[model samples]
Target: MVVRQTVLVCVLAVLAYVGLWALFSGDETETPAAPDAMFLTDYSKATTGSCVKFNGPGENDLGLTVVDCKGSRAALKIGTVLPNTSGECPRGDYKVLRDTRHNAALCLLPNAEPGDCFEIDTEDIQRSVVSKFDCAAPRVNVQVVDVAKESCPEEAELGVPYEDLTLCLRRVR
Candidate 1:
């Protein structure tokens, strides 16, 4: 009777071990999932056509600022939402380039108009660009659109004195 009892206990232990192993083990083909990516600002606060100032173009860590288009450091007016604010805004002349890294969205003035294909190199377009200028003057010419298609023009020996670049399209001479 003792021998039978011992044998029964051993079998039960082995079965229990096997059951636990099966329950804990995952499929060999399964892989751990990666965490979701995070952005700096909660863009949900913004609306379409609202004027906004995005701090950083890359990684968007600095966050966003809603500014007056007239007096503030307004970069772009929110247009048809690719990624931008969602609020009332003045009718914009052209769309500003989307800088995902900065989380920036600024538009040119209604009076100012973009010219040829403009290739924006910097993220701080508000600081880098001017209001409007003649295209012949050598500043970068731009045609703001909902989506950016054209590439930045190749730079030749030609270099301007280089001051504030026009955020609004500067018409060429």
Candidate 2:
């Protein structure tokens, strides 16, 4: 009887071990997934005519990502790349981004299209950002009439020179 009991115990131990091993073992063909690639743009190295996408909030936020110039995510275009010694962007509606750490600055212009409406900041144009709005919205005060116009028409309230063309803006409110 003792011999039979000892043999039964040994077989049970072997079965338990095999069952546990089978439960823990996963598919051998599966492999650990690779980490996602992180892409960071060095705004200081950005060149004139390159397109960028805003990455953070507020006008002072310099976080930007370089993207395709013709892509849908392109929000602003680099009009001029300046050194920190330049002080500020050229006079006009251009937005200024200063990178003191890299001693670089960028003059940016909104990638706006004709017929697009916007709500501009009348108090501080430099602090204003480009956010397109529906033409019928009550908050929309400015409208883009022509993007590549040489000169704005008499009806246009503001004209922003970008590259070789002029952005003819009219008061919509």
Candidate 3:
């Protein structure tokens, strides 16, 4: 019985190896071509100044899509890109996205602009994603007066500090 079992196992192993070899040693199948540059969605290659729509932390999906800076879908700008093992983004304010599989980190800046309005997320201030809206809109509670300026004007009710500058905001509520 032992001899029969050993012979059966050896036969099965030989069959498995032959099957795997036959599956891989094929010239009939053509290798797939590389994807086009425009269709590539890898955000790890994004550089400073590139605008992106990111899926922030705590969300089920985590990735980014590069978009036009002037477009409404652009939520953040790449302040800088670094390795996942690198230090934090330069102090002030920034949303950091680290992709462990890719070994990359993206320092993102809010894509806020003058005349744009936003709704603040109090629960997680650092993860508060900004989206542009009309100042007169009902949900628009904060309006930007100036960005990256020498200083926020005295008339501005709130001054949100950011990298190298301050965003002068006025209460819309």
The lDDT values for all models are 0.42, 0.72, 0.70
| Model 2 lDDT tens row, 70-127 | 5655657788878673666665567887777777888888767787777776445567
Best by lDDT: 2
On the 0 to 100 scale, the lDDT of residue 9 in model 2 is: 100
Q: Identify the superior model by TM-score, candidate 1 or candidate 2.
A: 2
- Estimated TM-score for each candidate: 0.29, 0.62, 0.66
Residue 98 CA displacement from its true place in model 1, Å = 9.1
Q: Evaluated with TM-score, which candidate comes out highest?
A: 3
lDDT winner between 1 and 2, please give it: 2
Q: Identify the superior model by lDDT, candidate 1 or candidate 3.
A: 3
For candidate 3, give the lDDT.
0.70
lDDT of 3 by residue, 1-173 (tens): 99999999999999999999998896787888753212214546777887776555422347566777787667567787776636577765677777777777877766778888777653344677655566777877788788855788877887777667787888888
The total number of steric clashes, by the backbone 3 Å criterion, in model 1 comes to 24
What are the RMSDs of all candidates, in order? Answer: 15.3, 7.9, 8.4
How many clashes does each candidate structure show, in the order listed?
A: 24, 0, 0
Write down the TM-score for model 2: 0.62
CA deviation > 4 Å runs, candidate 2: 1-41, 69-73, 85-91, 134-138
Query: Candidates 2 and 3: which is better by TM-score?
Result: 3
Instruction: Rank candidates by TM-score, best first.
Output: 3, 2, 1
lDDT for model 2: 0.72
